[model samples]
Target: MKATVDPGRCQGHARCWDISPEVFDLDEEGHGTVLVAEVPAEHEEAALRAAQNCPERAITVA
Candidate 1:
């Protein structure tokens, strides 16, 4: 699986990072950034959780 963050839609809520810090990272302003372009199998669950937990729905997972 892979995850991506939409910088334009993100509002620095940090929920994604809070759910899965291993897969999502936060910028200085607390907006999420994708830590890995391709998520490892072991982290796919966390990645999906992070995407779902994002209040802004700025995260995409596939």
Candidate 2:
């Protein structure tokens, strides 16, 4: 799966990073940023978990 973050919807909750630091990067403001355009197979689970953990639903996985 591939994941992306909607910057407009993200707050500074940091739950995405807390759940999957390897797949999501936090900006200086602590909002999540997608680490890659597409998630690698090995990291898909973590990416999905991060997406689900986002309270703002700022993360999308496909």
Q: Using TM-score as the measure, which candidate wins? A: 1
Query: Which stretch of 10 consecutive residues in model 1 shows the poorest summed lDDT?
Result: 47-56
Tens-digit lDDT track for model 1 on 1-62? 88999999999998888888888899988888988878899889988888888888899999
Off by over 4 Å in 1: none
Residue 12, candidate 2: how far off, in angstroms? 1.4
The parts of candidate 2 lying over 4 Å away from their true place are: none
Our model 2 lands, by Cα RMSD against the true structure, at 1.0
Clashing residue pairs in candidate 2 are: none
